[model samples]
Target: MNLCELLQATDGVLLQGDARVSVQGLCYDSRAVTPGSLFVCLPGLHTDGHHYAAQAVAAGAVGLVCERPILGLPAELPVVQVTHSRRALAQLAIRLYDAPARRMTMIGITGTKGKTTTAHLIASVLRAAGHKVGVIGTNGVCWPGYRQPLDHTTPESSDLQRLLRQMADAGCDACVMEVSSLGLKMDRVTGILYDIGVFTNLSPDHIGPGEHASFAEYRAWKSVLFRRCRVGIVNADDPQTEAILTQHTCRVVTYGIDHPADWRADADLTLLRQSDFLGVQFTVTGPDGQARSYRLPMPGRFSVYNALATLAAAQVLDLSVAAAQTGLQKAAVEGRVEPVPLQAPFTVVLDYAHNEAAAENLLTSLRAYHPNQLWVVFGCGGGRSRVRRFGMGEACARLADFCIVTEDNSRGEPLPQILADIRTGMQRGNPRTPFVEIPDRRQALYYALDHAGPGDIVAVIGKGHETTLQRGNETLPFCERDILQKYMKARSS
Candidate 1:
């Protein structure tokens, strides 16, 4: 494509360049620069890209995309300036890759919790409707025969474009992606325009120096999805919903269970359980003549919200009510309320509930099933908020019959110290019922399941679909499902 054409697609102003300048490739890192390559300068948490402009220039970068003012300039090197470097990179990558998002329907789901679940549900929803769908999120990107575990919620600009291009090549009709706050803030999703954007819910999370600076900043970054999409589908019951939606330029659609929302649910929100499985069942109705009954394998009232948001989002894409209904009913999300069959005695589930709110919610839902004894196996991540330990521990004590505390991604932090923090909260919530600290997660799960009676429920929390456990400089192989199934299979043998 011509240099002028590229700038037009990127919403970038060419400070100086010939329209006929041939483009070979695009890159952000200075090291990736070569002759005919355009280097995009993005400001990072640790360093400024403007500082590296000289290096990129020296590496034979013919063109540059930047938000910063050029310091020392050569007359021949062409530059394009934009309001934001990340957004510009996304747009440029999209144009360079031939606008793949426009050729395919795209769906984005954002929230503090339920993002992975919502994305999974939407992908299944689309596939059930006879569409070839691709999904990118917690379980990595998945298609029919090809599956690759993605390292980021949203990948780098070039990588994202490549994935979209591949999906387009593979004849996929739709793509569903999890839109993390980090992704939005960093402009990881710059180029693709979404057909529909779904907001599951929001809370105070991912807030720190390297992440969002404050709750207000987190909300602002999340708002970018609505601003960029054609339709903004949101949870009406969320306190942050109105504020998030009010600033969006796109058409708005809402779903909820708390109030009589546009897409509303029935009065009964029940958590149902059999010997080996537990889930939430509810009926939904909407002003747009929408009605369906769904029994999600996932638990908690949040599951209800996740489903409704998905349905409303499907509705925005002009899908039939029946198709959306079927999509959600058969939707399967890995790690979020993931099931593990145990014939030995009790029901066991593996979930990535690593936060206070999610832990409380999951435990509360399990409690509703009336298990003879609810056994929670949980732990905290290292280098995070130590305050969360108390909250998560207390939540399990209040809801679970007992808990087996263990390690979750303990990198450079002592497991004993982390266990001590959790014990502070557990002991404070209820000093009764046995609680043990077994630093190793696999062993802790064993202790819980081995002690469980026929009617007991064992929930292994944290490290859901993740295959590798981050332990200091080493990455340990850890698959919760594999560990759990092996143990259950041994008893059978």
Candidate 2:
């Protein structure tokens, strides 16, 4: 592509050099620049990409897209100036990647929770219906034979476009991605129009410094997806549903258990707790008014909502109800109320509930199982709002039969201080609730498993599906599933 051709995709003014300079690639990181690459200077929270313009140039960046004037650059090098480099990068990437999202059905799922599980469910449904599907979200990007980890739920626009192009070239019929609030706010999904947009549920989250200024802003960003998609599938049961749908440009389809909607699960929901499975069985009535019984191998009413959303999307796509049943029945999401196979009398589940709303929802759902004892081992991440530590502590204290507080990616903060804040919340929630502090997460998991009684439901929350543990600027390999399997095997032996 020529420099002038790429500039046509962006609202950028060419400031220097030949418009016909050949462009082979695009980059944002100065360290990753290569020969004939166009480097985009993005303004960030921690540092400015403009400062590294010289570095990118030295690293073989042939042309530049920047928000401000960069001094001391080659007089002949191609330069384009844009008002917003992030948005410009998104537009340029879409053009360079051939607008791959337009070639296939695109599904974007957004919410405070359930985005990952819902995305996987929708992908499974698409596959069962004989459509090749690709999924991108918390679990990373994956298709039939490809998988890769991502640093963010919704990747940067450039990386996202490249991945979409790969999926399109690989013959995928549809793509389902988790459109995060930050992703929308940061213009990560800027140029892609979705075929279906889903809102699972919303709550107060991702609000603090370097994030949304308030809960209202966070909700508003989530609402942005509906405006960019052709159809909106939303959770009608949530009180914030109306607010989220405000200013939405798409046709609306709703799903809920307590409310009348296009898709709904009856009140006679069944909670399953077999020896090898823990899930919910419910009957859903679609827009056609045909009721079908479906069993999801995941627990809670929230899981039912996820299924409803998937079914609603399936209905819109004209997929068979049989496909919805088969796909949902076999779908399993890692770290989402995932049950570990154990020979012991007790059961252990893993989840990625790091904040107040998520923890409360998961724990409360488990409480409905009527376990002899509900044991929760969880902790808050470092450098986040102390309110989360307090909230998680309070929720666990009130809901769980026992609480085992532990470390969760302490990052650069001291473990003791984080634990202390949790203790404060625990005390506030229920001063009489008994609890123990285990600073090491590994030991914490060991303790929870070692002491669990028969018929007890032990939940290990936070850091679900994550492979590393961050502590004081160092990230160490850590897999909870491996730890649990090793311990259970040794104990059985």
Candidate 3:
């Protein structure tokens, strides 16, 4: 592609140099600049990308896309100035990738919770329907033979476009991704039109400095997806659904258990627990009034909502109910009520319930299983709102039979302070609740497992699908599954 051709995709003004300069690639990070790469200077919170323009040029960046003028760069080097570099990056990426998102059926799921699970469910159904599907969400970007971890639930524009191109090239018929509020606000999904947009549910989350300014803003960002998509599939049971759809342009399709919707699950939902398998069975009546029973290998009423959302999407895509049944029965998301196989009589589950609402939902749902004792082992991440720590603590204390407080990503913050905040919330929630504080997460897990009684369900949460533990400035390799397997093996030996 040429600089002139790429500029046609954006309203960037060519400041200097030849517009005919060849652009082989595009990059936002200076450190990743290569020969013939077009470096896009994005303004960030910590540091301005404009400062690295010279470095990017030195590393063989053929042209520069920046928000401001550069003083000391080759006069002949191409420079395109844009009002918003982030949006420009997205535009350039789409052009460079030949708009791969348009080549496949794009389904985007958004909300405070259930986005990841719903995305995986939709992908599973698409796969069962004999379509090559690709999924991007909290777990990462994955298809049939490829899987990669991501730094954010929704990646930046350049990487996202590149990934979509890869998926399209690999013959994927559809692509489902988790769309984060921040990703929408940051214009990461710019220039990509979604075939179907899904709103699982919304709650107060990511509300703090450097995130959403307020809950209202967060909800507003979530609503933006409805405008960019052709068909909006939403949760009718959520009270905020109307508010989230304010100013929306797409036609709405809904699914829920409590309210009447295009897709409605029956009230007689069953919770199934047999040996190591935990699942839910429910019958849903769609818009056509045909009732069909579906079984998902995931428990809780929330899982039912996720299924409803999936079914609604499947119907919108004109897929068969048989495909939905096959997919739901086998679809499983990692770190989401994920069951660990153990020889012991007690059950151990790993979940990513790091917030108040999530913790409450998980513990309450597990209680229906009639565990002799429901235990939760969790910790709050550092450098985040103390409100989250307090809420999580309070929820666990109020819901669980026992609470084991431990360390989570204490990113440069003192572990003692985080633990103290949690203790305060625990005291407020239920002072009489038996609780113990273990600063070490691994030690906390061991303590819970070592003391587990027969028929007890222990939930180790907070660091769900993450493979690394962040402490201070160091990110250590940590896999909870590996640790649990090692402990089980050692105990058996």
Q: Write the per-residue lDDT of candidate 1 for residues 290-390, one digit (tens) a residue.
A: 46677777777878888888888777776777787677767777787777876766788888988878887788777777779889999998877787788
**Lowest summed lDDT over 10 consecutive residues: which window, candidate 2?**
268-277
| Model 2, span 1-493: residue lDDT tens | 9889988988899898887989888899999999999999999888889999999999898899999888899999988999999999999999988999999999999999999999999998888899999999999999989999999999999999999999999999899999999999999999889999999999888889988999999999999999999999999999999999999999999999998999999987799996446899999888888888999999988889999999999999999989999999999999899998888888899999998889889998988888899999998889999989999888889888899999999989998999999999898888888888889899999898899988889999998888899988999999998999899899789
Segments in model 2 whose C-alpha atoms lie over 4 Å from true places: none
TM-score of each predicted structure versus truth: 0.89, 0.99, 0.99
RMSD of each: 3.1, 0.9, 1.0
Candidate 1 TM-score, C-alpha based: 0.89
Would you list the C-alpha lDDT of every candidate in the order shown? 0.82, 0.92, 0.92
Give candidate 3 misplaced runs (Cα > 4 Å). Answer: none
Q: How many residue pairs clash in each candidate?
A: 0, 0, 0
lDDT value, candidate 1, whole model: 0.82
